[model samples]
Target: MQGTILLTGATGFVGGAILKRLHLEKKRSVVAVVRDSSKVILENVPKVCIEQFDGSTQWEQRLDGLDVVIHAAARVHVMNDVEDDPLAAFRNVNVEGTLNLARQAAAAGVRRFIFISSIKVNGEGTAPGSAYVADDVPAPMDPYGVSKMEAELGLRQLSLITTMEVVIVRPVLVYGPGVKANFLNMMRWLDKGFPLPFGAIHNKRSLVALDNLVDLILTCIDHPAAANQAFLVSDGEDLSTTQLLSRMGKALNAPRRLIPVPSWLLEGGAALLGKKALSQRLCGSLQVDITKTRNLLGWAPPLSVDEALAITAKYFREHH
Candidate 1:
């Protein structure tokens, strides 16, 4: 904790929040690695700009004298990815690039390499009550998940042969201020009073607030128990789609107009429209068991679901 910390993806949602927290803690020995320095608004934080972040990128000078390297930069999962070879694209950056950085960091005598992985590495969803634990066998379904899974594997292998400790943190769907895509759209629909068909969605999902995730990452930075270990993180609470929407409605002061559409009917309709994956995400269960995370590192999500939801809603209303 006394030495310099190098953080990647400083402009991203999770990374930005971590950078802000580090800044608030008045840690001046932090170096932010980014593709665009102008996008990073945190003052007094040194930055090293790299135009590209693939396997060939060099990090010798950047990793020098660094105690911790938080690798948050990756080709994130997106809906309907347009890449001709999505797996290759993700592997190029997520796997090869990550391993490349880890190799260099180890050679440079970096103490620890913390990776921000995704729960997709544990597969898409869980049964009604069962949840994904830290040691679950890898069952990544898509190219992105496969890439993250590969990255985790490569990091673990590298750690076995090197002195640098590796920590992998796999978080569930993360949402907070400045969230976009589906979560934002859900807020929009709620604000507009659109009648959603999620009233009957009894499936539970585990989500992490940006604050909670940042706290976990920071905790992993120096915790001895976290070294060479993978963690499954969540808000420690699972909510049904209906419950999530109802909470959002309360946070936004918006009327809930959800209709009790049968889950089978919704799935069938979505399959007919070629939106089966989207429907599964909206109406499926993807819970994670964080007991290992808690017992090992004594870590618990510092923010409640409703508290984080309200913060996210407040930001949404103020900004949009």
Candidate 2:
């Protein structure tokens, strides 16, 4: 046995993908914590041990004997405006829960603490020509991003007083089969073969595939460079929004049905609805240079965009 790896959110999109790979490549034991794990979370990963650990419970015992902890659990929603307070709800889980677990992991002799933070922590929306690097100051606009930023800061502070190595991975829109939210909406559109006018819009954005991110996370658990460091990871290949959509359609076996709508028209429409910031999120370039990660850890993104998209499409076809 290569010791135990405790995974929070093991049944989640990114967490499940990582857990799936860990059992395949390594001899270590993985303890997957889930609220209500489905059969798929247990399938294929024969070596994974299951644990019921919601964020509400105390974490000291849960982290015991674990060599590494990959925290992937969070309240991931686009917007939350409840009667009381929206930001408070996210803060309770994303910020408080994360720090609470990290404190326990540190007490339990956990070697590494891998945090699955979002690029939203850097900023919710993008500005023109404002591609950020790892060192740039965060400007999280939304509640989710704000919570994540607080978690990162808290982890850094925790590291000052503990032996647990903290590694934060800030990933931009992660897409693959079983993807949710707007990315999934785009698929429904492409599945119908609806024509889109995004062909002319040229905006480069960085993205991480399931496989690439999973591999990087495993590597970060013990890699010397990843100790007490943050990384902005992608597939190492930058693509314009148009290119991404075209590739996505091709992967799904749908032909590119792009019309040429003026970028200005879309921007104007977005501005009118007070969605200009969101529009930037959709069409703006938030390119991240993974050069530091590559140089420091000697790691690279495993799958190209085409390869990743094909895997996603294949999975979608098998189930649907």
Candidate 3:
């Protein structure tokens, strides 16, 4: 808690929030690793450069005095990757780059290395009543998920024979201020009062707010029990698709006009349009039970879903 912390992906949505939180702390000496220093939106925070996500990048110098390395940088999932071998491409960054950084951090005497993984490692969808836990076996469907799982396995192996402790956090869909992708598109639709056909699609999905995730990462940095452990984190509340849209409408102060369409019809239409993946995300059940995280780390999400959604909505209105 009192030592220097090195953060990667400081320019990303979740990473930006973490960087901002660290800036406000004023207790820990923080250094952000970015591709370009000019793109670092946070002022007064020291930065180092790593131009590419590759194994060849040198990390010892920047990681020298760092007590904790929050490895948030990765080759994020792309809907349509035109790469020759998408799996190999993901492995090059998410797996190879990650292990390289961890190995260097370990050799540099960093005490803890926290890897931010994805819930996709647990699989795509869950049973209606069942929720994912840390103990679940890896069932990564796509290349991105598989790469993250490999990184987790490699880091755990590294922890076994190294002095540095490794902590893996598998977070569900993370949304907050400056959020993009599907969540942002959904918010935009709601803001415009677009009637979505999710009224009858009753599916539960788990999510972590930016603040909650940042708090968990900070807790893992120093918490003795969190060392060499994996945590599945969320807001500890599950929401139906309809409920999520309704909440977004409320946050945006827009009309909640959801058309009551059958789940079968929605899926069928998505399949016809070659949007099966999108449909699964919209109508699938993916929940996580954070009992272990709460029980072990004595941690709870500091923000409720409504409060977090309000913050996201306010930021979107002001910025976009």
Candidate 4:
């Protein structure tokens, strides 16, 4: 049976990945709430309607007979000045706009509402030798995480008050083809035959692939176990920074020469030069336990870390 789905962030990296997958499946009719629906990311799939990012889209009328709503838009940044008002900007889009849509969906009797959140809602970085499970307390640290946490709380609260189902997905450092910024920088360095100075730094981190995340999102669309549940998601595999970079390099046909840099020295330099954010990226343990997501939803991340890396490498190879 063909169903109707409303997807925000449909043009973004992770969301675009989801849209690419959805394009292949003819089972559902997907309508995206885009900043620009005419600016197509994928061709010959379908037309994206509703050309805005706010709650004023009269979504209540449009959401009529919809099966699911995927809220994947949010304010994203690795670092921000504390003095600046990122929260206000995010709230306008993330918090209030999200609730507005969810409320409209609930009013229209939509079946499920899926939210794409971040592990930053749990903690900035996973503690050493420990991973966050579904039951762990949420202690959001930054403005972005705090806002996401608040949105999660709002969704949970709304679910309690309404008949709408809510499913939340937390992705950790999702990397695949078409990735940008820090992850891309790492790939670029590897592409140029530069070895990352991260060898021998054994810190485990969890990551989700673009394809795997799409699979999970589709699964969550109708999965009964996702109702009113907050689950931590990972690739079901953890690797050190060096290992991840190495796999990426191999996938790109780039040389893999890793230099052993002491973790302490690297971290110390970052801390000294206001580069702590980069340090966290280079050396941090951010593992998440996906046991609950698997047990409850009967779903598993489809791609192995290596498989995802290879795909990303291939993407760079083909594109470059």
Candidate 5:
């Protein structure tokens, strides 16, 4: 924990959060790997440049003397993929690039490699009253999920054959300050006081705040039991879509204006609009059980969902 740590994706949202945390700690010497060093916001952090998805970087030399490597960079999932071979595109970065980085890290005698994986690796969603556990069999539905699963399996194989330790963390939808993508869009919609037809949504979703996810990553960095293990993490509280929007409204000081619509009608409408996937995500249950993570690492999300939401809301008010 006190030695040099090389972190990828420092310019990204989650990675930026992690870098901010590391900056405050000031205990470890952190080097950020990025395409353009000038864009790195965190000063005092050294940087190395590498072309993503190419596997063309000189990693062995770059990784030398580094104690830990936190791999958070990958080809993220695009909601509407335009690539003809989406799986191949994802494999290029998430699988091939990831394994290449790990192989070099292991060869360079790095002590540990922490991989940021997705809950999609577990499956699309969960059944009502059931949640995904750490030991659940991987059933990736999309190309992106498949790529992450492949990288995880390959990293575990490397760990078994090599001396380098590997820790895999699968996090649910992560939200915090500077959050973008669908979560950000949702926040904007709620902030504008747009009425949503999710009042009757009884489905539960497990989400991890950016702070909580960063804490887990830091825990895996030095925890001996974290080696060769995979963890499922969240805020330890599940909320329905209706509840989520209501909280967002509270944070934004907007009225909770939601319309009651049956799940069946919502699904039917989404199907007609070619937004079935979006509907499934908005109206379906997707909970992660973090009991293994809690019992094994003696860890719990320090921030409650509402506390995290408040932080996010404050940031939004100031920025957007």
Candidate 6:
């Protein structure tokens, strides 16, 4: 934690938050690797612009003297992917690009390399009481998940031959202030008092507040036990879709307009409308057990789900 730290994806939500936190903590030698320097707005932190992450990208100069490399940049997963070959596209960035940079970091004598991975590597969903653990046999079901799983495998292999330690953190749905995508859409729906049919959803999902994930990442930056290990992270609290929506309503001061529709009906209707994936996400269980994270690092999520939701809602109201 004392030495210089190099971070990728400085303009991204997770990376931006991490850079801001490092700045506020008065870290003296933090460097942000970005594609566009203009997109990064942090003061005093040096920005190193790398056009892209591929085999030819020169990370040697930028990685010099860095103690830790937090590789947070990647081609994120999208719902309606328009790529000709989605798996190849994902592999180009998430797998090949990741290993390309990691190899350079290890060769540069970097002490540790932390990779931010996704819980999707554990598979799409779980049974009601069964939660995913860090060491579960990987059952990645999509291109993005497969890419992450491959990157993880490559990094672990690299760690075996290199002196640099590798740490992987797999987090479930992360939401907080500046959140976007599905979480933001849900908030917009709640704020507008839109009637939703998730009132009876009993499926539980584990989500991590942005702050909690950052805290765990920072802990991994220096924790001795974190070397060559993978940790599953969450808020340690699971909530049903209905429960989540109700809490979000309270945070936004919006009325709960959810109708108590049965899960079977919703699933059936979605199947007919070709929205089975959407409905499954809303009503299926995707819980992750964070006992490894808690016991190994002695870390607990600093913010509760409600507290984090309130902060997220406040930001949404001010910005949008």
Best by lDDT: 1
What is every candidate's alpha-carbon RMSD to the true fold? 1.0, 2.6, 1.0, 1.9, 1.0, 1.0
- Local accuracy of candidate 6 as per-residue lDDT tens digits, 1-320: 47999989988999999998888997546899888756746877889888888756777688888899998999999988999999999998899999999999998999999999999889999998999999999999999999999999999999999999999999899998899999999999999999999999999999999999999999999899999999999998999999999999999999999999999999999999999888888999999988888999899999999999999999999999
Worst 10 residues of 1 by lDDT: 36-45
What is residue 239's positional error in candidate 5, in angstroms?
0.4
TM-score (all chains, Cα) for each model: 0.98, 0.91, 0.98, 0.94, 0.98, 0.98
Q: TM-score of predicted model 1? A: 0.98
lDDT of 3 by residue, 139-207 (tens): 999999999999999999999999999999999999998889999999989988888889998999999
Instruction: Kindly list the per-residue Cα lDDT of model 2 for residues 1-320, writing each as its tens digit.
Output: 78789888877899888887887876788877776544456654432333423356576466778899899878785632563766888888889888888988898899999999988888754455567677679888888889899999999999989998899999988988788777777777887899987877887788889888888888898788899999888898878778888988998998789887777787888899988866786667788878888899999888888999999888777876
Residue pairs clashing, model 1: none
Worst 10 residues of 6 by lDDT: 36-45
Off by over 4 Å in 5: none
Which whole-number lDDT from 0 to 100 does residue 165 have in model 6?
A: 98
Q: Which is the better candidate, 2 or 6, if ranked by TM-score?
A: 6
Q: Write the per-residue lDDT of candidate 1 for residues 180-274, one digit (tens) a residue.
A: 99999999999999999989889999999999999999999888999999999999999999999999999999999989998889999999999
Candidate 3 segments whose C-alpha is farther than 4 A from its true place = none
lDDT of 3 at 177: 89
Candidate 1 wrongly placed segments (more than 4 Å): none
Clashing pairs in 5: none
Residue 268 Cα positional deviation in candidate 1, in Å, after optimal superposition = 0.8
Error of 5 at 97 (Å): 0.4
* Deviation (Å) of 193 in candidate 4: 0.7
Q: What lDDT does model 3 reach?
A: 0.92
* Model with the higher lDDT, candidate 1 or 3: 1
Clashes of 5: 0
